[model samples]
Target: MQSDKPSFVFTGWHMLAAMLLFFGTIITVNFTMAYLATSTWSGLVVKNTYIASQEFNGKAAGIRAMLSTGIKGTLAVKDDSIRYGLAMPGDKPVLADKVTAHFKRPVGEHQDFVTELEPAGAGVYEASRQVLPGNWIVEIIAVKDGETIMHEANRIAVTGEGK
Candidate 1:
């Protein structure tokens, strides 16, 4: 006669070791990811605000130069907000009274995205302009201490929900 019982393939010691290893790895990875994520988020928020503040004119001017070359650069649309950047060269950045973006609608009407920006530092000025869905032409003008220094233009395409 033979009696049947479930076999214990893994001993308690082995199970405990495996569980410790697995949970340790999981916790380590989670902590590392959280740290990276927090750092990145803070950096982005500060950058955006700096750009919007119009403080870094030199940096911002350089960005304008890059975009005017008809090459796609740092401008992007995020959740109904248009984010663009520029860099100017000098000891300081210029704050502008107004930056006007001139574009033509697909139907041939003209539109403008305009704003005044605050200075962020290192010659970078940042601002945001509301934009509609369609093709766009972009231009920026900078005036600092009552002097105009840079102006350039480019084209872009905008697409998303409600554009």
Candidate 2:
């Protein structure tokens, strides 16, 4: 007499089911990662890539000319403002005709901001605005005689430790 228990057998149907489950899992994981990555991603900075590429050399030349001038500067982030301190070849502090600060987030463009830093004093420019505490790429520009006399960029972290 044979027992009523059915013998379990590996067959084509089992193989097909396993393959579907494996492929389905991979597809689901790939989609999930793609979704999470785009939330804070930022694309190209240049509006027109072709134009930017064509004018890249000219822009570099202008920046080089600006750096040739013996000027130095420092930027500090404050609770209510960003301070820019500049100096010429001499130890004396000097203020350019126009000064601006461009702040951009490392990961995304949503929090990026650009504003002219007002004259605080001799060789000092300040922009009064609260900045979110995190990573930032700062570009400081000083314009003199209708030309950019200096351009400087630096990466910094703003921790709300003191605040």
Candidate 3:
């Protein structure tokens, strides 16, 4: 005669198995997310933080001075080009003899570019570029006497298709 009965009691092996599965899933997910974040990150906001910090005060003062002088600018996107316009208080639209446009993508540095604008009219400048539709940080630098006389930086919304 043999006794046949199913055991329904909890055991150490069962507890160990459940714990292993629970912790394994958590560890796997954490590692995967960490890998993806590091791989996509560009790192470093500035090459030398100390130098940038040193120049920060002067830059702020210069911007304030330029603002009071009634220097104004606008940026627009056209067909594979960016139309820039400058408004100065004097006779000419551009206050400086040389004007350059600098574009930077906030998310990454690889998309950063610079182009010198050709005078389209008295106050208008035209520069052609293949710009992707997103947030763009623009700086219009006006140079005179071999130095940057005035600069304006603003964020612009770019629409339309991107390549």
lDDT of 1: 0.56
**Cand. 3 Cα-lDDT:** 0.80
Off by over 4 Å in 3: 1-7, 89-92
Q: What TM-score, to 2 decimals, does candidate 1 have?
A: 0.39
Total backbone collisions for each predicted model: 33, 0, 0
lDDT for each residue of candidate 1 in 1-163, tens digit (9 for 90 to 100): 7669877688899989999999999999999999987764433334477566777788687767645644222345445455444444332333345443444443333354455544445344444545666677666565445555456566777776535
CA RMSD of each candidate after superposition: 15.7, 2.6, 3.5
Off by over 4 Å in 2: 1-8, 161-163
TM-score of each: 0.39, 0.86, 0.79
lDDT of 2 by residue, 79-145 (tens): 8788999988766787689998999988888789998998888889998888889899999888878
- Please, what is the whole-model Cα lDDT of each candidate in the order they appear? 0.56, 0.86, 0.80
- Per-residue lDDT for 1-163 in model 3, tens only? 7668876989999999999999999999999999987777667788899999999999898878878878677778766887877777664576457789888887777778899887888777887778888898988887768877668888987877842
Q: How do these models rank on lDDT, best leading? A: 2, 3, 1
Let me know the TM-score candidate 2 reaches against the reference structure. 0.86
